[model samples]
Target chain A: MTEQGTTSTALRESITAGLRQAVKRRFGAAADIDAVEFTSLGGSNRTVLFDLVDGTARRRLVFRQETIIPANSPFLDPARQFRVLSLLYPEGLPLPEPIFEFDDEDSLARAYVVAFVEGETVPRRLLDAPRYERARQRFCAQAGEFLGRLHALDPAPAAFLAEVPDSIDPLATTMARIDRWGGVHPALELAARWLERHRPTSTRRCLLHGDFRTGNMLLDEEGMRAVLDWECAHLGAPAEDLGWLCLRSFRFGHVDRPVGGFGPREPFYAAYASASGHPVDPEEVRWWEIFGFIRWAHYNVMQAYGHQTGARRSAAFAACGRNIALIEYELLMTLAGHYH
Target chain B: MTQDAPSIDELLVTVREFVQEITPQLDGRDRYHAQCAVYLLDIVRRELGADGTDATAEQAMLARYLGDGAAGAAGLAALAAEIRSGRLDARSDELLADLTRQVVGKVRITRPDQLHPMHRESRPAE
Candidate 1:
């Protein structure tokens, strides 16, 4: 959070003024915009919260804008994000309701406003807090079942996704992105080569929540409420989502709890199999898990590079460069058959 | 070339103290940033304390694996491209051992805490 009287305050005020008018025009009502506040410094988008007072009721809405400098991920696109939410929201998925999206025509920066759904998104808190005890008990099986249902959806209707070239051959696309990051390591290189040789050819393709991990999920006392961060969603093998969720990093120190630090991997797999009618293959999931580590390590290095190259300046990113070594350490441990 | 009063070690200690001094005063997001600042300084301290042979050993492994004298990021990039293109065998035990050595060497400096509990017993003496 920036201090008051800084340049950020001035910019925030200007954005609030513009947003007040935009909200009135979109809602077709003279609603009063009480205040606009920055919520999170997102990786690919800037998130803000504002309240709209309509007569006697007040509604809290969130606005997400495509960051000026986006993270280097193949699956990120503003239009695709909107399209997925628009499609999934109707299918009864627990996610924020889309209010409106702006494109080139809108004078304000390209962004979308949605209903603010609150819950816990942090990992350690979800893992350790007694408040989330109920959520922890049901999270793994529910998350697996939810992902299975998502993969069961017919991706054909979202044909606009075909415009994104990397929708197919995610391995080659990931390899290209890693090479462009300019930081290389033998462990990552080995993982990529090994994955290339062992990549599975799925008989069935479906939409994958490319980042369905604990940190991305919002949980309450009841259980998982909404799966957030759709920027990385894409069409791929169903097991890829499972593999990513079980990655050691997402486990947040509970390496024993392979399924998002919630429970063992078998129960999660069993739930998914029962729900989707597709038997889970453990070997394929392991291969994708190795792929996940390599992808994550490369991403950390890329984030640091983003700061180093003047594309973005962040204290957190500078720290991320150092964090890559930790991921590389885990990558080697997994590759050497010593992780388990 | 003139005499400097504060050595690198003293500078690191000063920064650590400064972070401690300001930590209690900050709350919420500012506190998190301060913690991150301290973490960066800790990494710098570890880097300074390392014996500094890790890079040389890593380069040697890269040279051996690539079967050429290639050494830095350019060399590693070329090697990665080779492995991806099937010019080099990625399944060889010797290659795996060298890559493991490289990863272990890095983690020793950047984050020894991540080293496997079993592997920690075999860490080379400084």
Candidate 2:
């Protein structure tokens, strides 16, 4: 029983009316309350896909809630993450324009739900179906530009400033945070030890996707529409964000190259640096790549829990648990790759 | 070691089978028991398989990264093993795990053949 995505702790429908009421009150007549239906999907949070009309228009909105999973963020307050999304949406990040957020005692059993955005987020299918290669430059350039914009965001924003931790060594902090996840298994313990010794110095703190990578974003031929999954979003070293995108794991199988199935490391860095006006460091890139493994490993543990306890048991979590090894192996290679 | 040397997959199958068989028999709510079974199976399975590859890899990584630090830091000097041996009994699992982590870019890129993405995040938009 490999743990799959974040598993539901209180999956039972304890209070459906309360959630609908919360939505109706916050979004109000703007969302056309009479014509909406909610259906829950996914295991990480209670994901409800709601079909509703707004001003003689129909829209399908998605909402998410955090459930019980091993290795969940003890440090992160879900309300805090929701608040961050609320703040950043107005600033023009390509993220789903978050609408109607509430994290209290009776919101879908735990911290849950915001307005859903639409887009297909597939990387495996990307290699075969309607390839982005046709629109690679636009996709690449747009992603680079978008990331640059995010990087350039005034850390001065009260929304961002209030919640995000100001850590001196964010790289170590990231590893330490993830290392906490490794305790679930002895092998992950190995992963923890591996990350600690290899942690890198911080370049400049910027916003992190927390889970930024290939599978976490939405893109079309034109380019990235928006980044998704801010569960791990925080202000951190700028190199961390770029490095996360470049992490080979994000490439899925495209290890020969990096950057979410893009061309190569140099191009991805060049595109980002050009757009953001920040110098790229191979060393820092290397560091975040390790952090990516730590993050992935924790997520993997969460996935295992989702499969074992929660309902979404499938080949997905079982196979994903094995992925932890890939990251561990990659770490091995990264260490041995340039050992003196 | 035949009984003990079950492949990771085999162990997982056994755990799943065991949980599936016993969960229905539990006196309490079937779903609750079933959920408990799933998590328990996962824990057992992780303990079974995580060691062979992860532990050995950690050992090899630490040996490689130590890079002549302590004159006698070389691993299994008797075996003359280079970095990459991931055996818990073989070395410092704690330190080696961290060292390999640093070297491999942390994404833990392994042979694609070894990994299979169980659930890919298919972004909702093209």
Candidate 3:
């Protein structure tokens, strides 16, 4: 066999053996794994889907493992993410059920298993697919309701999340990342100054799905199935999540539908207000939306830096460097009140 | 110095077409990377086609605010520092307009289609 082919085969064998060990330990010795498929979904994590068969019963599960973590990455480590999932799974949130976390005995380090939720997570498909038309109609209300419930969850149990820089001060955290990445972006600096000056006064801190947006959600024709990607979960202002969902970049060409390219802001805010019994503050949300743009730009810059420095070479990352221009344009337009 | 028959722009177009032609055969991650490649090629083409006028104008605009010797990457860093320090707060309106023009120039190269209709129309004709 060719050297590359031989190496891949050996790698696959090791993964299968590691998973077999995990399955046997969790589901008894009789249980075995079948059809392990690697999913290229997350940028900074490796996700594998597989079927664990115990006698006649078969269960589909996801094996999510941490990949190369960039220095000063904003995302939580796998252990912390799993902890967050375990803490929130019983809170009636629409999230995947956490199974078992990988231990030292398992060959796979920094990984965990969860019950696989079936739904589409791609933003393009969720936004444009004809099959998702009904889902799109119901998405805003569902998102608002979900966010309301998520934000209202008791923050005491997730106290560990407070260590996240975003939980302390999201704007400052993003600016720090930008600076570390050698981002000399004047547009982002301008946005940061604006954010600092017009900072929201509300001190209501709650558990936030720090990367709350359309792409991170799993949806079907009925509506949202589960909220995935908990790596960014933190304790922060509820409006932060609300604004993140309304980011212009997340609108995906459906600029008219301000809320995740699904519907207008009023219905979403109304749903949240109805659910949480807290009146939606448009001004605060607007501040967060501007902050969201800066945060998004920082992420892009970080990815581009990774590509440039050879930490993780990817065409997608290279594209991110160029995409910053579009993001900057939109951010400036939003700041100038030229875009709604 | 004379260049080859296939200019940089021509080569970019040919490679982009090749990527598109092979894109159908690829799936999943490869296809996504191919799409990104096409996007990067387009950006490069637009950047190459652009005259140096926008960049020169941007430098001049920055010099107006930061005085002479403020140009290029150093000028941008200085502008950002000034903005961060609130030294440019009084001139925010003018600064925002100039920054918008600069970002608009960038967007024109990277993804002009994303620009608002007003901004698109305001872009100087090539």
Interface C-alpha RMSD per candidate, 1 decimal: 2.9, 11.1, 2.7
DockQ of 2: 0.11
| Clashes by residue pair, model 1 | none
Q: What are the per-model DockQ values?
A: 0.57, 0.11, 0.66
lDDT per residue as tens, model 2, A1-340? 3222222334323334555666566667465443333333334545555655557776666656665444434334556667777778887778876665564544454464556655557777654456666655555566666777778776655334335443344444544554443322333344445555666665466665556677677766666777777766666677777777777667756676566676666666667788778867888677667666666665666565556665456545654555566666655545445310
Question: What's the residue-level lDDT of A111 in candidate 3?
Answer: 95
| Candidate that would win on TM-score | 3
| Model 2 DockQ class | incorrect
Once fitted onto the true fold, the runs of candidate 2 whose alpha carbons sit more than 4 angstroms away are A1-16, A27-42, A54-57, A69-75, A103-115, A135-137, A158-203, A301-322, A338-340, B1-112, B115-126
Deviation from native of the Cα of residue A130 in model 1, angstroms? 0.7
TM-score (chain A only) for the predictions, listed in order: 0.93, 0.76, 0.97
Candidate 3 lDDT at A272 equals 94
TM-score, one value per model: 0.92, 0.64, 0.96
Better of 1 and 3 by TM-score: 3
- How accurate locally, in lDDT, is each candidate? 0.78, 0.55, 0.88
For model 3 chain B, where is the 10-residue window of minimal lDDT?
A: B117-126
